[model samples]
Target chain A: MTEHTLAEHTLTATDLRLAYDRREVVHGLSVAVPPGKMTMIVGPNACGKSTLLRGLARLLAPVGGTVELDGRDISTIPGREVATVLGILPQSPAAPEGITVADLVGRGRYPHQGWFRRWTAQDDAAVNEALTATDTIELAARPVAELSGGQRQRVWIAMALAQRTDLLLLDEPTTYLDVAHQVEVLDLLVDLNVTSGTTIVVVLHDLNLACRYADHLIAMRDGAILAEGAPADVVTTDVIERVFGMRSRIIPDPLSGTPMVVPESRHRMENSA
Target chain B: MTAHAVVAGVRRRARLTTLVLAVLAAALLLLALSVGTAVVSLPDVLSTLAGQGSRATDYIVLERRLPRAMTALLVGAAFGLSGAVLQSLLGNPLASPDVIGISAGAGASAVTAIVVFGAAGPPVALAALLGALLTAALMYVLAWRDGVTGYRLVLVGIGLAAILLSVTSYFMTRSQVTSAQDALVWLTGSLNESGLDELVPLAIALTILVPATAISARALDLLAFGDDTASGLGVEVRRTRLALLVCAVALAGTATAAAGPIAFVALLSAPIGRRLARDGGPALLPSALTGAVIVAAADFAAQHAPGLPQVPVGVLTGAIGAPYLLFLLARMNRGGHGG
Candidate 1:
C-alpha cells in the first residue's frame, strides 16, 4: 500500500466566475492551492466556498476563466484521467440501498477500471488499505445503512482514500458530526496529508477546528478571498468578524499553540460578573 | 471479510442466479413449444428444434409455436432490461418505462403512424422508438426544476401518459374498423397476432440495444447515489445518462411496436428478479430472465387456461402489474420518497 512520493500538482483557478442559472454566485476569483499542505477554506454559509470547491473538483463548470491542473486546462482533460490524480468527497453523499461498506468503498476505484469491469487484487489491496487507514476495517462487512453517523462518515472517507488521489478536496466534511467526531475526522485527514503527502483542501464551518488543523488558511466572504496564509496571519479578529459577521477574541490553543477563536457571545459579555 | 472475497461472493451470487433463471426460461420455452392440440412429444420437439424433423412437425414448431414463444421471450427481455435501466438511473423503484408512461408514448406514436400515415412494418417501429424518446424527454423537462425527484417524475409521466393515451384513442376513432382493431390491440398490449413481422424486428432491436446497455450501464451503480457523486467518480454523468436513456427508450419502443405495449413486463421484472437473485443491486440479467419467464408463462396460460377465455398476453400481465403499482405507491408514500 506504500505510495511513491507524488509529484507536486499545481491546482489553480484564474478569474473564475460561477453562477447558478443567471445570478452570479462567485465573482471572478483566482487562487492557487499550496501543494502538499493541509489548506482549509472557511467562511459563513453561502459565502461561495462550496461553489469554489465544486469548481476546483470539476463538479461544476466555470462560466468564465479557467481552472488549470498542472498548467493545463482541467476541463480539456478527460474525466477519468483527472480522477486518477484528484478526488473529491462532497458533503452529504448518500450510499446505494443496502450496500456493504466494502462494496461502497470499492466504487472509489471506478476511474482506474476499464469499461469491462474486473476487480483485481490490486484494487482489493487499495480498498483494504483505505479501510485500515480510516479505522473502518471492522465494519467492512456491515451495510452502510446500519452504521452510525460517525461510522458512516469514516466509511465515506475510506472510499475517498481508496481513490488514492494525489490531491483531495472535501466540502464541509464535518457538518453534522459532534465535536469529538469532527476532531477525529480532521486528525485522520492530517495523518493522510502527512504520511502520503496528499495535497488536501477542505471547506469548513467550524472556525476553531479549521484554525487548529489547517497548515494553510484561506478566509472568504462575499464570494471572494479576503486573506490567505498561515492560521496566525489570516485568522485575525478583523477577518473573522468580516467573514462570519460575529465578534470574537483570538487566543492561542494551550495544547497546540494554534490560533483559536473564542467567540464573544452576547450572553458571555452581558452576563459575566 | 476480505474486499476481494466480498466482490467474488457478489459475483458468484449474481452468476448463480442468472444460471438458475436461464434454466427456468429454457424449460418454459420448451413447454411453450410442446403444449397444444398437437401435443408434440419432448423428443420430437427437440428434434424439430434441431432441424431434423418431418415437414408436418417442422411446420407446427417453426411456423406456429416458435414465433409466438420467441415474441414472448424477446419482449420480456427488452422490457426487463429497459425497466432495470430506468429504475437504477432514476434511483426510484417505481420509475419503470411503462409505469412512467414511456410505453404509452410509444403506443401513441405507432398508432399515429398506422392510422394517420397508413404506415406499417419498419416505419411503425421507428415511430414507436421516436415516440418513447420524445415522451421521456418531455417528462424530464416537465418534472425538472433544479433536478428531478422520483415522485414528481412519476406524476409527470402519468399526466403525459394520459394525454398520449387520449391521442391514441382519438386516432382509433378516426380510423376504419380494421385500423381500429390494430389500435385496440396496441392499446391493450396484446401478443395474439405476434409473428415474424413482430419477432424479427424485436429480436434485431434487442441484439443491438442489449449490448449497448450493458456497456453504458456500468455507470448505473455509481449514478444510483446522485449526479454529483457519479461525476466525482469520473463518469461523464450527462453523456452516460443520455446514452443509457436512449438505449432503454429504443428497447421499449421496438418491443412495444412488435408486441403492442406489453404491460407490467417491464414493471415487475426488476423487483422480482432482484428478489429471486437475492441481490440488492440492479440484478439486470436476472431481471431480463425473470421477464422472459413471466411472458412465456403468461402467454401459455392465456392460450391454454381451462376456465378463462382466450385473452391477449397483456391481459395477464396487467392483472398482475396494476395491483403491484398501487401497492408500490402506497408503500412509497409511507416511506415518504425515493429521491
Candidate 2:
C-alpha cells in the first residue's frame, strides 16, 4: 500500500446562482465548507440542496457568481488539477456494461494520467487500496453488472475513494440503500474523514442521519439556508418545521446523543393514535 | 493484490484476441490478392508484391487486385473505428455512424456531386466530407435541448437519414441513364473504381484520426459513468465530446467518399469485435481488424466465387447486418434497453 498524507483544501461558494436551462435552481447561495470537517446538507426534495452541491463541486456552472477553491476562482483552475484536489460522486452513476469492478474503479486514476502516461505501479496500488478500504477486494474480478445493489454501491464508493482527493463531495450517496447499508456507507465516510482529515460534504435525504454524522449541519428550503451550525444547534423543532414544513419534535438519539427529529404526521395526534 | 492480477489477465486476453484477429485479416487479404480469373498462387502474389512477378502476374496483382483489396481493407478499418468511437460515445450498441445517417449524408452528397455537377474524383470526395460534417453539426444543433443525450442524437440522426436518402433518390431519377448507372454502382458502395485517388487521402486521414481517437477514448470510458461523473473526473466534457464526434464524422465521410458508403460495415464491426475480444471497453483496434477481415473476405467472394454472379461486397454485408439489426431491435423491445 502507498502512504496517504492528510490533505487540506478550502472550498467556498460565493453568492452562487446556478440554473438548468431557463429555470434557476440555486439562487445567490453563499457558503463556506469547513476544512477537514464533515458537512451535511439536508432539505426537502427539489429544494435545490443537490443543485447547491453541484455548484460547489463545479459540476454545474453558476450563472451569477463564482466558486473558489483555496481562495482562487474554481473556473480558472484546470479540470484535472481541480480533480486531483476534489473528488465528487454523483447519485446513481452507471458502470459500463460488462465492466469488471476493478476496471471500473481503476478509471478513477484518469486525473493522474496524461496522453503519454500508461498505467503505473502507483495506480495499481491505489486501486488495490480502494478495493480493500471498501471491502470490495474479493469482488474485484467480478463483472459490475452481476453485483448486488449494495455491493455495486460499494464499488462506486471505492471508485471515488481511488481518486484520493482531499475534498470529497457526495450527492445523496445513500439512495436505494436499505437502513443498514445507509449506516454502513455513512460510517465509511466518517472513517475517511477521521483517518485522513478529508473535508467531506454530503447531501442526504435522511435528516436524522445527517444530524448524526455531520460535524457541521445546514438546513435549506426553497434555495435558501434556513439554518447552519452544529447539528444540535441547527436541527431544532422550529428549524425542522420551517425547512421540512412539518411539525417535528427534536430529541436526543439514545446511542449517540445526536439531535434526532421525530416528525408529527396525521396519525400521530392523541385521538388518532 | 488480486485486482492487479485480474486486470493484467484481462489485458493479456485482449492483446491475444487482437493478435488473432489481425492474423486472420492478413490471411484473408493474401487470399484476396492471390485468387481471381488469373489463377495465381500464394507465392505468385507474394512475389508480385515483392516486385519479382512476371509482367502479367504483376499487372493482375499489383495494378488491379491490390488497389481494390487495399481500398476495401482501409475503408473497412475506417468504418469500424468510426462505429466503435460513436457507439462508445453514445453508450448505445446501435449508435453506429451508418445507422445514425453520417454515411447517408456522405452518400447523398457524393451522388449529388456525381449526377448534378457531372464531377469525378476529388471534387465528389470533398462534397461528401462537407456533407457529413454539416449533417453532424445540424444533428447536434437539433438535438440540443440544454444538452444532447445519446437517445436524442440517435433519433435525430434517423430522422435526418430519411431526408438525405430522398435527396439521393431524386437526383438519381433526374439524371441521364448512363450517369445514373455510374452513380448507382457508387451509391451501392462498389470498389471497382477504387485506386490511388481514393487510397492516398484516406491513408493520410487515418494516420491522423486514429491516434487522436485512441487518446480521446480514455475519456470515453469515464463517460460511461455519465457526464457529471466524467466531468468530476476532470474531463472537459464538451470539448472531448466534440473532438470525438469530429473524428467519427470525418472517418465515416472519408470511407464513404472512397467506397461510396459500404452497407453495414460501420454498423457491424464494433459489436462483432467486442464479442470476439470479450472486452468491456470499446474494442476499436480489434473492430478495425474485424472489419478488414469482413470486407476482404466479402470482396474475395465477389471476385472469385465460381458459378455465382459477382455482386458488390456491400450486398453480402447488408444481408447479414439487416437481420442482426432486427434481432437487436426485438431484443431491445423485450428488455430494459427499449429507451
Clashing pairs in 2: none
As a whole number from 0 to 100, the lDDT of residue B61 in candidate 2 is 89
Residue B332 CA error for candidate 1 (Å)? Answer: 1.7
Give the per-residue lDDT digits (tens) of candidate 2, residues A133-182.
88999998999999988898889999989998989999999999999999
DockQ per candidate: 0.64, 0.70
> lDDT (CA) for every model shown?
0.86, 0.87
* iRMS values for every prediction: 1.6, 1.5
Clashes in model 1: which pairs?
A: none
Taking the tens digit of each residue's C-alpha lDDT, what string does model 2 give over B270-299? 989888776577888898888888888777
Q: State the lDDT of candidate 1 residue by residue for B213-263, as single tens digits.
A: 888766877887678777888988888877887888788887887787888
Clashes of each: 0, 0
Model 2, backbone clash pairs (residues 3+ apart or across chains), number: 0
**Residue-wise C-alpha lDDT for candidate 1, range A49-145, written one tens digit per residue:** 9999999989999999899999999999998888888899999998877788888899999988999788888888899999999999888778899
CA RMSD (A), model 1: 2.1
Query: Distance (Å) between predicted and true CA of A76, model 2?
Result: 1.7
For all predicted structures, in order, the TM-scores are: 0.95, 0.96
